[model samples]
Target chain A: MIITRRTFVKAAAASGAALVLPGTAPGAPPAPVMRAVPSSGEMLPAVGLGTWITFNVGDDPVLRDECAEVIAAFFAAGGRMIDSSPMYGSSQPAIGYGLEKLGRPEALFSAEKVWTSSAADGPAQIEQSRRFWGVPRFDLVQVHNLVAWETHLETLFAMKADGRIRYVGITTSEGRRHDLFEQIMRAHPLDFVQFTYNVVDREAEERLLPLAAERGMAVIVNRPFRQGALTRQLQGETLPAWAAEIGAGTWAQFILKFILSHPSVTVAIPATTRVDHVRENVTAATGPLPDASMRDRMAAYVRDL
Target chain B: MSEWWTYRLEDFLLFSPRVYWRLFELNNAASWPLHLLTLAAGLAIVLLALRRPPGHGLWVAFILAALFAFVGWSFLWSRYAAINWAIAYVAPAFGLQALLLAIGGAARGSLAFDRRDIAGRLGLLIAVVGLVVYPLMPLLFGRPWSSAEVFGIAPDPTAIVALGVLLAASGGLVPLLFAIPLLWLLLSGLTLHAMGDSQAWLPLLAAAITVAALALRRIAR
Candidate 1:
């Protein structure tokens, strides 16, 4: 028997798949449900999958298989929201393919974005992606990086009115023009806003995160690992005991738990190339998250280290 | 060693131009020594491509330009070192690599891509990831807190799993085959580095793999 941890897990996971339900857990707590998405009034899983680098790639059978395993793991563990974009290279197709391969995309919350620089190009992209994904309607659409929001938002709103998509939102990772983002948020009826907000990058805490909380707008966190730098930072170190106090097991869970603990933050999407990472990430979704004091403590701990 | 860089492999590309840029900042702009090496390397690429035997050296030119932007200014004495001061060479390197691949592929008549092509591309990705992932083990987990007495239990199992991932990968089919997934996700690693989290040496490792792969391919041809 090879008996390697990876092999054992792979073998066990294969058998477990046959016995598991499509979306419901066999013995787990209702997967820690969240408040209904304020705009759509549909409850969304607190955790969503981020498809940045992991999903963006060449569709080798191995890559597709890895993706399929990840999507299957995500759905079986009770995840629904999947944040992706055309700008993220091949992420969209990969997700659709992975879900279709596993025969379980219906258990997904397909939230993608329109990242075109041109206002005229946004709608065409949305329509093209709809056919490409083979989904009759999109669950959510957002302006990527706030490229041409003024024009695109109107088009997105019209799509929402037509029921082509369920919700509309905006996103940005750049810090230079936050005031501009604030202005848009105040004036718009957006359902969500996605952006980078890791423990190190606390710029969003000042306004964006809190503002989303204030408006009851669902907030999605992109680049939660600070794009992998934060994780790399924790490498080779023992996870502090305080981490487990906040419901974190691995360093990944620690970082993710910190974001999930935030009152304003709705979902923190950490993209992973390996299925093991998907499993590790899902573990954080188990209830009893870090409280405010723990979050503050987490900040101090990461900052000092 | 070959006169010109084979394909687009350089010390700077190993860790992303961004890391070197940040490291340059770490030294309070004192890592000027590395910059001089970069400019020379960059010029060497151009000279080797233009003046020497011109087989398929266009990729070498990409490395030359990439190195120049990545380390030239940070090192010192390269022409246009100042321009690279404000920007990391990531974007430019991506564009040049893409152009070189396009031109090379077009020249070789590889326009139509199918399923098997995915394997080769994914191979490139694994090389990228293996280069960027493992060596970065130090950064993903903090260096174990140096202490006199063992407190609260040693590293957790996950920490063990995390740090164990740092060990240099064995040289074999697995590493080469797994390169693309590794490489593709490694770019996201930059996201972590930007946030002052992990301290991955994977990028440097990836660059080395890139060079090795290029050399191997050149010899195989």
Candidate 2:
């Protein structure tokens, strides 16, 4: 009776038979669709939560509480992966504060990054991140933007071996350092790699993603909204008529489903400050994802935009 | 601690350029028509500097002090402190500048209009630019009027105006007034540059011109 990652995901998908809005349904909301890491077969919800600028509240209790509600909504919708970094000012600490207010849900799959040139300071930075998230150890610690990666990757590898962190990886976002990122994905024995991938920014689809699949590394897609550029550009536009077929009621869901449709993508973390946006984001994981043709159509539709 | 020195200018920025500018837009939205008053006040300060009435230094000081205090209380403390922790420490520096200006003015510090010199003329021109031209940046950039940055309400133009005032004034207290504004211009310029903001170069240029004019004035003296 050993339940594998596949069986767990199947059970979770079966539970997501129907979508319900907040406070409108009599029962707990539908569980999100889950994807398994190709490397270790550890399953995670297809949609993860990112804490970049959205959670950097800078000690404001009201804003902190608001972020806590966003976390609450995320977990309530069956989200597990909450990705953050030390480079993002006040974001990690705010995540800790939010988790504190939310009573530290057990589903938390905390992911953080070390961004320092000094190899000696890498452990201290990760320790600070641990303190910030109020977690005993991170589930994943990545090299942010590949800065001093040789130094930090060594630290991450040792931490992974010692179980201080469960997984060691690297990340680049906003399409920066992709050439080097691709090289690392090919050469290194990393467990996970995160980079920017969305409808408009298809550069990752060219090499990084396929390489992740080939290398059996878990892929986390970031900047799914292209840092608000996509949303702002598509503002005032109606959702596509066929969006309802895939259960995408909003653009957030629509775009997230497009990312999740990729076979290599384990999770897409869309950061947000608003609780409603979090609900919208997490609900993207609840329904049938777009297939290859729908993904092509989605790309064409956004290209014309 | 060893890695602290490796940080780039972008590392200090808490948000994107869009979010940063959106703060100015929100500030403008919350305080509409206050920009008009700020424009008028800036013009009045320049005019008073030109008139050189008795205790005119104190008059300009009173106005400049009030502007710093307003930026500290209304903008930095109320708006920015919510996002950036470094600004909370910097807000008190603005308060300190306000006090310094108060003391200099009360002590009859010399801050008279001097248009005969090139530095004086250049300084006055820069001041007027801050008073009139700074607010139009949002409109020129295709942004709504709600994103307009003005003196007394916003930091950039207020700092520029302060530099202009210092450059035009005939006083030993010029360096004291120049310190904080210049530091802010450098910091803001770096931050804006890192954010890929088009206005990034403006602060650096303003800082250069202010310093050059002040240096020219000193040489002439």
Candidate 3:
């Protein structure tokens, strides 16, 4: 039962048998159709969970049980690709606990970061993150917020070539260093780059994002809520009828749909500390995303906000 | 923000045009603290941008003196010797500073006590769980320092889960939230320092900064 992506995907395609897993409900939710990376043929779920602030969320044993249930719900409903960072403080371990409790760590597309600044230290940090998350081999290893990125990147690039890691990347959530980030993208090869690009920060669209698509790099989004700013602004708001085109039933879905419309984006990971939010975030994966014209209208909707 | 910080901010903004920009270069934990410091400097310039660049216009002087006053008092009040370096020494300073800043932002965001705030609060709480889980990181599977050494470096996953649960409970129980994270880091650092050289004052420095930031956050609250 040696686990590798080739072996796993082979098994998945092999098993068309209607297997009833523990997490699946009676009227089980439909899993998102698998999207493959044309370059690698490796498949990723379109939506992933970001484990930034949600690490400390479930304090009550009951709440945690519910949280675990929500996670069970997430997978049963069809989602994968969980992003975490040690810089995120506690996201990795909390997710580790949830996955372990659910006994489905294998189903996850585990991505974690090592934010330590030393290039010499990047390899060790990535290894530590993998170990902490209890994943057999990480699907992705990203240099968080571009910490010691050169050091981490050099290490990760080598790791990717060696098959020690499958995908490598750098992230910029703060939106402060994106121009510099563009320079990094121009200079080196990377599988992914994460950044904040909610309606509030469209700067990524003008330069870095188009560049990612042109270069064939996967993009993961953070702060889809602008750290709750967007949600607050839209409080007491109604879902516009135009949202129906994107298949968005709620504001969460609308925001995520706006993000997914760009062909370059591989996934959008909005961190939530609660099960409902997790479920809500994952639902964005289910429906049709906005087209170019729709994206423009979505922008107009937000600008009017 | 201290007297030295003010000086650093002023000079950094007004420095000769030769600016050194390193994106995710060598020591990245240094990146965050450096970011905060640099932004603080940037803010000074930003403030000056609005006013005429008189040999120090009223607004420019107000902005400079205000930045100076703000950061100066902040640094003077901070406990750690602010020579931030690595995770052991500097990360606590930067990491906790970021945490405190976020906490301030969250509170300002009125994240606490909101009915729907449950999700955001849960996010921060999850971080607490993560912090509690931090000690076990060495014990658990690791982000190895090197790829070649991945297999050889083993982690002990036993004590950390228990510690995480315990710390998560107790840390959140404290009246002043800083006491919990600060105290946990304190005890944990002392334990690490006792065990090996790699885990010495770095842990303590991290703990101390976290505490100072938490203390300030309380005031900001």
Number of the top TM-score candidate: 2
What interface RMSD do all candidates show, one decimal each?
A: 16.3, 5.6, 17.3
Candidate 2, A39-130: lDDT as tens digits: 67777888899988888766556667887888998888789999998777778888998899888899999999998878899999999889
TM per prediction: 0.56, 0.71, 0.54
Interface RMSD score of candidate 1: 16.3
Question: For residues B52-130, what per-residue lDDT tens digits would candidate 3 score against the true structure?
Answer: 2443222322322333233222321221111111123432433343344234323322112211132223323333433
What DockQ does each candidate score versus the true complex, computed on alpha carbons?
0.02, 0.23, 0.02
lDDT by residue (A1-305, candidate 1, tens digit) is 21234433443233221111124457663464353565555766667888765665433344657777888888877788888876665566677788778765677788889978899999999987776566777889999878888999999999999888989999876343678888888899899888778777878877776667556577888888866768988987788986867568788888887776565566677887777787778767665676656667787788888
Candidate 2 ranges beyond 4 A from true positions? A1-26, B1-13, B16-158, B170-221
Q: Can you tell me which runs of candidate 1 are displaced by over 4 Å?
A: A1-26, A174-176, B1-221
lDDT of 3 at A249: 83
**Which candidate comes out best when scored by lDDT?**
2
Error of 2 at B15 (Å): 2.3
Taking chain B only, the TM-score of every model is 0.27, 0.93, 0.25
Ranking by DockQ: 2, 1, 3
> Where's the lowest-lDDT run of ten residues in candidate 1 chain B?
B148-157
Docking class for model 3 is incorrect
First chain TM-score, candidate 3: 0.84
lDDT tens per residue, model 2, B90-184: 89888988987877777754555555478877877888998889888887777677778899999889989888877777666667888999888
Best by DockQ: 2
